[model samples]
Target: MKDILFVNSRFLSQEITGVQRFSIELSRSLKRILGEKVQFIAPKNIIHSHIAKELNIIEFGIFTGHLWEQIDLPIFLRKHNSPMLLNLGNTAPIFYKNKTSTLHDVAYEKFPDTFNWKFKTFYKFAIPHILKSSIHIFTVSKFSKKEIEELYKIDSNKINIVYNAINEIFKPIKIKNNQRYILGVSSLNNQKNFHSMIDAFNQIADKNIKLYLVGGINRNFASTKLLDEIDKNQNIILKGRVDDKELVELYSNATCFVYPSLYEGFGIPPLEAQACGCPVICSNAASLPEVCSDSVVYFDPYNVQDIKDKIELVLYNEELQNELRRKGFENIKRFSWEKSANKIIEIIEGLK
Candidate 1:
């Protein structure tokens, strides 16, 4: 009999954002550690067939998306004697008491303007109940843990911090590129502070140094007024929704990677850039300072001039860039999928 059931509903319905990436990588590590003791379950409509096949996911339920998660998933678990459920994505079956959930951040609560009304309303109604019902909660950083505790009035001891690590594909590449460009990766949204980053990039004195923005727009988020500006600027390139290999190449070749996000559970892109031997210029906001530590050059996300200054500081200095790359390599050693997986196993065992 399976000891744990992984709610993989995110794989079926949602695209791979930071939240889904957390679930996917953690599940992979858990599967390696737990073997047949754990089983991954998802709805019948699987968007990530490659992932489903690798995980050997069992498809069930007539309903898809949240309907499948709320209705069919609980019913299915009930038939199986209600094994311990693991929900890595933000949401879970609200009524399932035997579950452990990973809530990445309280962005929806803190920055409600970033999301649509329906999305905000649903999470506000559902998340507290889910946290209360959960056996334990897992979040990505200390910043998030404190936020969750304060916002939901949950005990600090009940939450676990599982830091995100770069996938093997993100490692430093030996290839050389003559072209120079600054890189930014994340979904296009107000929370990302892309408007400020764009403005900052525009003010950069070097006309030849381009800025490449990688990622697609998330519809659930309220759109930022960046498209018209992007169209007007020739130096700013938007490479939307790249695959892992392409992302690694972009990171490896970038003169520097700039992340101007106002808030994060634990920023992953900076780590990915670091793993590819790229220097990082990051906003010292929210959980980013905790995740990045001293590895990245810090800037105020709200200040366009500060963002540009930091970018240029790293971009122009080869010695400083190399030092950051060295520190980044060292910083990355503190996190790994396997290590996080082992921690989860320990927690599960303690419960038993």
Candidate 2:
């Protein structure tokens, strides 16, 4: 651990979302286990200042954006002669040699319609090179490991499967049940399938149920063109990015939680919904099945009608809801950020 440094480009370069949360939570967990052996470095311009303040991050880099990651990071690593550069985010310096990087998913390539051309094109070129160059590749799920191996034609042995756990913050709270709404949280991207969810919500016979989209439209990326579509639907409310406390409230008292993502590396929200004691209704495609297992009611992501049917079934079925809630409690015990952090250190030490 003497010559190792954790790269914090993604932490500074972007806002605190699921991805940045990964960097923060994992860093905290790793710090507890490894003590001061773990250190961090990032750029100066950070969006999530409160979260960043918690970590002992050395903020010094010439540039900020993509150039900071690609050029500035690698130069710093070279100057320090770092033995291992742990890149917790999906992208890393393509030139860095002795480093491990985590690839959350390859959704952009598989679902090009979900992303703008700029976002897609940058990843298409950067990820493959980053994966190939890294000493070890870490992914969030078995589904993602297989996807990366199949797409990049890399040896499966090189990619480590580190599961993403529900943050401890998402506990069941004794909040007043004022709202009877179905909850969905994700960036307003095409692959999130929020539009189809709206269509599905409209089909449901239950006139009383309202659908809430929790995450905001990401202005950093090209607009998903969903604001108008969401605006048109009266029952649908866009809560766009809430604080952790508010999010837990939304999760705790909802009638149900819905995750209609078309694809994911590891579907953390379903596990989150489960942890918060909300019954999960999610897509049967990609990593959702692998992550949620028997705990969630599944629907075909491509079929709007299928999503509708599943949501309705979960809504009215008392026995099914109770059973899902039980199984969800049992299922969440399998993933731990502490365990994940330990495994990550083992991989780094093993490669060394």
Candidate 3:
């Protein structure tokens, strides 16, 4: 069996955040297929320790002084001397030569304003070299793949598109009494464009319909007016930092899922909603259109009236909802964790 070292800097806790979940699932799937000897590089913390239990993978923790993980990871990597390396999220070990890196998006290169100065400075120093040295590049969506090829001037053949899969836990729930609520889940940041979502939802003031938001509320960055409206109108429920079970139940029961993001590498919320048999209304922005395909109702993310109109339309029209459901089932079939793991395995084993 070929020895492969997988490295991730983020908190890889049992709780399934997007990137963490992807890494955990991939590692576990690989171990099951290829055996337990394959190594992993992860953070030394309670979060990652829990991930080891959940994924059931053998891993070595790298205590890389908290700030710049890439700089210190090479020591652990050299000690193990694995044949090939795969950097999951960002920042690969500097010393590794024959290494592949997965760029979830060109978020750092494209949206500098979103990150802090320190991260921006670090990216400026590290990313160019990482791109130059990487053996193969992978991205989560076609939109990001194209962008990376164009921006990095890398060969299209060298880049692979591996779309993120909705966790198997997101299965359909029996519709108990025809629920009427629009659901959104993500961080309340500029990228999510939740302010616009609130504005759009406010316009569709249907007495029966409610808007449910599941994410951290950035009280400082968020608009006071939107917060006030959410507080005043008992229609909106802001559930901050929920468990996967709670999120699954929410998706299973919701009338529709709405995601109005400005940009995404691969929008997972829509996929999760589709898997849970919820009809979706999302923006045609970034990689969302590609992920949603023809399964979801697309609205101009910036247009409040368009979002409001689409939400109203989905609620009123039974035919449209049924059509989306049929198409969503088909769309979800195109993606799975097994398929993703198989692809990753081929790539890892094929490496010279």
Candidate 4:
């Protein structure tokens, strides 16, 4: 049996961010199907100590300080000597000769202004070389597949679209009755466009209906401003950094999920909401449309009034909500970790 080494940062062990969840679930799915055919590698000093134990995984860590991460990832990868390397996150090692790396999206390339300066600079400097060396590249959505191929001038055939699977925990739960609140789960970054979301919610003008913001608790860019918005409007609730259980609880009870992001790679939040039977109102931009489709009500992400209008329509119309629920359940069939793992294994076996 060939050895497959899964490589990623501490997220594999800590925090349930979209990337972390994707890597962990994919790894678990691989282990289940490939049994004794794969080895998971990651930094041992992750923020979530219980994650590895909960998942029943053993990981390895390095001791060269942070320098090795940027400078010696390729060397460290070589030392491990695994036949195949899977990079769940960006920045694969330079010296690795055969590898399949995931470029979740060409977000930075598509909208450079969405990312901070350091990340943009690093991507401009490093991604081309990584692309040149990687034999196969996987993305989370068809939107990303096309973007990467066109932007990087790579063959469309070289880019594989392995859609992300939703957690079964996000499946429909009995939503609390008389729950008149709109929900949003996203990083408090410029790309998320939470500022625009706040402006839209403020226009709702109904004190009985509140707005809840999940994620981005301590983040500097949007937290302070978000708090200020909440202070002025007591109807806005900032329930920051919730765990999986709490997130599912929020999803089950929310009136609807609003995702007015300027752009996204795959947009997992809408799916999570839909899985929990929450009607979703999302922006018609970037990969958002690709992942959500007719499963949600589409709005012009840049227009705050459009967001407000969609939010009101979904919340007021029971028939529309029921229809979206049906569509959401049907939409979930398009993704599966089993299929994704098999594809990865197929590509690995095909490598000459």
Candidate 5:
């Protein structure tokens, strides 16, 4: 009998973001460790067919999207005698009691204006219930674990930290490129602080170096002046949503990768850059310092001048860039999908 049933509602309908990426990678790792003991399930409407096939996910339920998650999924679990459910995504079926769910961060609670009213309203209602009902809670970082406890009054012992790691595809590649460019990757949202990064990039004295931002804007997020700002600068190139192969290539060739986000549960891009032998210049905010350690050149995300200075600090100095690349390579060894998955397995086994 399958001991754990993975709720893959996020895989069916949602676009791949950091949260979904965590779910996908963690689920893959869990499957490898658990073998036939875990069963993965998803809704009928699927957006990621490649991922769906690779995981050998079982599709069920008449409803799609949130309806499938809330209504159809719970009913299916009940039919199976309510086996222990593992929800790697931020959400889980509210009514289900025998489940462990991951809450990536309290970004919605901390930065309310970053998300739309509808998204905010649903999270406000759902999160509390998910926290209350789940048998256990999982988060991506120590910072996020603290936020969830303080914000929701959750017990410290109930939450588990499962760090994210870069996939093997994001390793160092010997790609030849002549053009000089800096890289930034993440959704163009208010909390990501892309506007500040762009403003900082504009201040750089070198006109030859270009800034390439790779990510698409989510409509559910509150609209920003990013598009208008991007139009004013010719040196800034926005490469909307790229494949993993292309992203690895971009990271492999970048002068340095910059991540200027205001907050993160556990930032993955900087580590991905590290895995690709690219130096990192990152924001010294949220969980970045904890995840990045001494692997990156830190700058205040809110300060455009600091961002510019740090970018130039790594970009111009070949020695500092090489040092950061070396540190990054060492730092990435602290996290791995298999390691995190084994922790989760131990926790589940302990509960039994």
Candidate 6:
């Protein structure tokens, strides 16, 4: 087998989103299985990245983010003979050929209005070049693979499905139930559809059940409109960001978890919620149906009334809740970070 060198500059530089989490977890799993055969390479400038602490990272770039990944990283790769590079995030150096890149989604292209133009512009230019140049492409879901193929016109065989997985931190735990509240973990991005979710929750007759929103709730970069809409709501409690322990606790104690994302390459929170034994109600869009299977209560993402109805159904029906929880555990069985890591290695081997 050929040696693999993982490009982890993005993992070092970016915050822990689902993409970053997949990168870090897959790297960790790969390191355990491949041992010294797979080594990690990253840039010098770092953030509060938890994964770097656990892995032996060779950090050596002065530039950060895009500049570092595109310029410094490729130059560094050349110095090391450009060993087969594996990028776990969406972006990869277009000039590099002996590499595979994992793109989580095409939300930038699909919902351009949600992002600042800078983000949308960069991706619209970068992704096609990256996909064309990459030895193979890795994505989190079959839905994403198909989307990438259609958008980029790449052969379906060239893209692999490596599914985003529930972290080990998410497990069923016995926690004293909190006050009647439904939980939602998403960013303040427009695509997360929090506006629709909050509206839906407001329509529900159960005034006692509050909607607890978590993760990047107070992001300074978030859209003013989204922030204003969420801020005006009295029933929606914004939990800015919580550590894994706190998140697990919140999931365990919640009545049910609702994910009303308009689109996703692969949705992880619903899996996490299900792993923590919380019944899930997610949008029947994109990869949600693929990931959750028949385990989750489906609602139309665009319809506030549908979301409201689904939430109420899950809340009142104990039998439905029990059925979903049972199937959630079963659905989660299909994905594991270790299994995903092995699949990545298999793809790499085929590329070699």
Q: What lDDT would each prediction earn against the true structure? A: 0.88, 0.82, 0.76, 0.76, 0.88, 0.85
- Pairing residues by index, what is the TM-score of model 3? 0.90
Tell me how far the alpha carbon of residue 45 in candidate 1 is from the true structure, in angstroms, after superposition: 1.4
Clashing pairs in 5: none
- lDDT by residue (tens digit), candidate 6, 160-239: 89988888889977766658889999888878998888888878887878889898854655777767766887777888
Q: What TM-score fits each model?
A: 0.96, 0.94, 0.90, 0.91, 0.97, 0.96
lDDT of 5 by residue, 174-252 (tens): 6778889999999888889998999999889999999999997665562546787787788888898999999999999
lDDT of 4 by residue, 123-217 (tens): 88778778878888888887878878887899987878777888678876665477578999987777788888889888886669989889855
Q: 101, model 4: CA deviation in Å? A: 0.6
Model 6 residue 218 distance off true place after TM-score fit, in angstroms: 6.0
What does the lDDT come to for candidate 6?
0.85
- Tens digits of per-residue lDDT, candidate 1, 1-352, equal 2366455455546788898888889888887877877889998888889888878898888998788889999988999998888888999999988888889999998888888888899999999999999999999999999999999999999999988987888887756777799999998888888999999999889999988999987654635458878878989898989999889999998999999999999989999999999999999999998988999999999989899889889888999999999999999998899999888878866765
Better of 3 and 5 by lDDT: 5
lDDT of 4 at 58: 49
User: How many backbone clashes are present in model 4?
Assistant: 0
What's the lDDT of the predicted structure labeled candidate 3? Answer: 0.76
Please list the residue runs of candidate 3 whose C-alpha ends up more than 4 Å from where it truly belongs after superposition: 4-16, 56-68, 175-179, 218-229
RMSD list, candidates in order = 1.6, 1.9, 2.5, 2.4, 1.5, 1.6
- Over 57-149, each residue of candidate 3 has an lDDT whose tens digit, in order, gives 334454533333554556555676645777776566655676888878877777666666787897778776787788987889999989888
lDDT of 2 by residue, 81-163 (tens): 66578888788888878889999988888889777788888999988899889999999999999999999999999999988
Which pairs in model 4 have colliding backbones? none
Q: Model 4: C-alpha RMSD to truth?
A: 2.4
Task: Pick out the ten consecutive residues of candidate 6 with the lowest summed lDDT.
Answer: 1-10
Give stretches of model 6 more than 4 Å off. Answer: 218-225
